[model samples]
Target: MDGSDDKRLDDTLIALRRILRATELYERELAQAAGLTPAKLRVLQILSGRKEGNATPTAMANQMGVRQATVTALVDQLENRGMVRRERSSTDRRQTHVVIAPAGVEALRSAPSALQQHFVANYQKLEAWEQQMILSVLNRVALMLNAADIEAAPVLTIGDIRQDRGRG
Candidate 1:
């Protein structure tokens, strides 16, 4: 409404843009280093996080918040790369589980999580109250931006924004 309010809004928007840009650049670097696109790498990461390093396409779609068709395509790519294998579920013959191959695990290990390294290192240095305040503010900001419903995993990477927008 006033000059001060306008300035604060502009600054907030700029900071958000910087965060998005940095995330995009970091995603590109991580993908290049791992020799995989961000989306494919994400699929491998998700599979690795599973209890047995395996999951059905439907479950992966749910976890990644993408379409089943998208997960299927990613699985196909990973299979071609020898990063994953599709095995028919023993209990349910109708479903196939995507299992991460040894190579995939190696790749995951080799990929340096730049975002985590940068954020965690700095975040750990913050005071306890400062960390709590930051978490609270970030949660509030996410709610304000209508992003509260986005299913974000512990892993950090810029997800497919176009696909997410389609879901909305």
Candidate 2:
């Protein structure tokens, strides 16, 4: 690539990494302030918005890209705290499903919103075309990264995988 092309590529990569880190850090702090580990909060968030039977252990493991055993431990902790409960799947009888408890819903309901309100307020004030251009660039960057094939393992963010087993 030419010098300008190389510079652009490096700048794009750096900016994307920084944005991801910032988002993860924000999520981690918010979850902690809500009295939850990041992983548990994500699990609660996932369960809260789902259909009744959808938050199975297998589904959660796949969504989080973790092993089944890890999900089991997470569920165990949530269950102990009365945030989640496991039920036998009616159709299979052998499969277990997780549902959020009322306490879980109330706990999460009291937490602050995820993104900073000021960011949204400011972003909305930008011209429509400017907003569209920003989104277009971000979409293209995401697509290009997704299409590349490499041997490197996917980087786990605080939300993607916890650091202190549950600290996010």
Candidate 3:
């Protein structure tokens, strides 16, 4: 590649690294503020998104791209903290579901999403076409970086990074 192309590539990589670092730091800060580990907080967040604020452990494991054992451990910690409760599924008595307690909802509400706030604040200022362009570029970049193959959940927590590495 030409020198200008090399420079552009370097700049793009640096920007991506900055975004990743910011997300990692924000995850730690959010976890500390919520008095929970990132993984635990992520579990609660996933539960909170469910229709009834509950999900089966297997489902959570799939959503988080982690092992079921990892999700069980997180659920146990959350239950101990009174943030979640285990209940037998109504449709299937043989299955158990993890439900987020009222405290879990409160914790999630109180947690500050700094990265989201920053992104939303800036993103809202962009024109509609600009927003679309940015989304397209980000999607292309994700594909270029081979992240498209990863089964990432919609949750914004950084807990998946460690889980991904563990799998590798």
Q: Point to the candidate with the largest TM-score.
A: 1
TM-score for all models, in order of appearance:
0.67, 0.56, 0.65
By TM-score, rank the candidates, best first: 1, 3, 2
lDDT of 1 by residue, 1-168 (tens): 999999999999999898888877877777667766556767888898888879999998888777788788778777877989999999999989999999899878877675755888999999999999999999999999999988664445577532322111
Write model 2 residue lDDT over 1-168, tens digit each, in one string. Answer: 999999998998898788778767766666666656656666787798787634898888777667777678778877888988999888999999999998788768865565534456777999999989987986676578783332211222343343334442
lDDT of candidate 1 at residue 4, scale 0 to 100: 100
lDDT of 3 by residue, 31-83 (tens): 66776655666787889889877899999999888778878877877787799
Question: Which stretches of model 1 miss by more than 4 angstroms?
Answer: 1-3, 114-168
Judged by lDDT against the true structure, how good is candidate 3?
0.78
lDDT of each: 0.78, 0.69, 0.78
Native RMSD of candidate 2 (Å):
6.0
**Model 2 spans with C-alpha error above 4 angstroms:** 1-17, 115-156, 159-168
